[model samples]
Target: MKFIIVTGVSRGLGLGLTKALLSSGYKVAGCSRSRSDALNELEMSNDNFKWFPCEVGDATQTQTFVSDACQWAQAPLWGLINNAGIAKEGVLATFPNVDSDELLQINLNGALYMAREALRMMLRQNSGGRIINISSIIGSRGYTGLAAYSASKAGLDGLSRALARENGRRGITVNSVAPGYLDTEMSSTLSDSKRAQIINRTPLGRLGTVDDVAPAIEFLLSDGAAFITGQTLTIDGGITN
Candidate 1:
């Protein structure tokens, strides 16, 4: 059986990715800041699902989380989804230092820690694996109020490109998926006017959903995507185009 790890499995896109992986017949070991009732329910119902509590920004905690997951699976891990992330929005000029640091810690460093640890395990197994970082369209495009969040995501894209080149010879593929505005709690804070503006700009006439994003990640983990690496797959309804 294939094994994969997904961070931030308690809600939103992370939860959707976990469900997709489980449904696709892969055993998933997931983590979040806390175990939510929804995650607990999933764990209880799905024999192939396991959940752990972790603060991905903490290097020690991230290392331990992946170590424990690798041990629990007792098999070669096939893929990793660096899906755990947080966003802080503010104008660039006044974006608080504290929020900037925290955003980088969780959004950028968290994915780095997980991917680094997972890569170690994948290398030892001698069968290269997939690493898909969940990024954002804001990383590539400019948005006035999300300077810190955008920087963190752009960093993820750079990480993916560099890692893919470093590990390509070993069959380990590293890539990123950058989604546009999504209808999740993450975007719920936006004003109705802002949301309407985004929808009007999007050719699809709507924001993305977890379902719209999860399949791209799942595909990256599939054999068909073996030839694809070091790329950022944008799911923004052609907004970037």
Candidate 2:
């Protein structure tokens, strides 16, 4: 049997991805800093799904989380979804160094650490695997007050490209899924005017949803996407265009 590790499964896109994978018949081991009632409910209802507490930004915690999840699954590592991330909005000059540092540490470095752990296990097993990082449209198209958040996501895309080249020969694939402004908690703080502006600019006339992005990820983890790697799949309702 094969199982996938998904980080930041407490809510929003992370939680949606977990449910998508579970429904797609894949076993999932998910991690987050803390548990929510929704997450606990999911764990209790699904035998194939498990949750662990982990601070993605902390290397030691990430290491332990991965190790423990793997041990509990007792199955080959099939894939990893680096979905755990946080966003802080402020122009670089005014953005607190501490906040920027924390954003990068989790959004970028945390993904690297998780990829490293998953790669090590995949290599030892001599089997193929998948690593899909959840990036954002703001990474490529910069925003006025999201300098640090943009940089972190851009770095994640770069990480995917480099890792794809390094692991393709071993039958492993790495990619990034950059979604447009979504209706998740991450974008909940958007003001009414900002939200309307975003919708007006987007060709679809509405913000993207978790449902719109999850199926693409489900496809990436499938054999159909074996030939696709080192690429960023933008699921933004043509907002980037």
Could you tell me which residue pairs clash in candidate 1? none
Task: Estimate the Cα RMSD of every predicted model relative to the unseen true structure.
Answer: 0.8, 0.7
Task: Please give, for residues 153-194, the per-residue lDDT of candidate 2 as tens digits.
Answer: 999999999999999999999999999999999999999999
lDDT of 1 at 144: 89
TM-score of each: 0.98, 0.99
**CA lDDT of each prediction against the hidden true structure:** 0.93, 0.94
Report the number of backbone clashes for model 1.
0
Global lDDT for candidate 2?
0.94
User: How far off is residue 40 in model 1, in Å?
Assistant: 0.7
The prediction achieving the highest lDDT against the true structure is 2
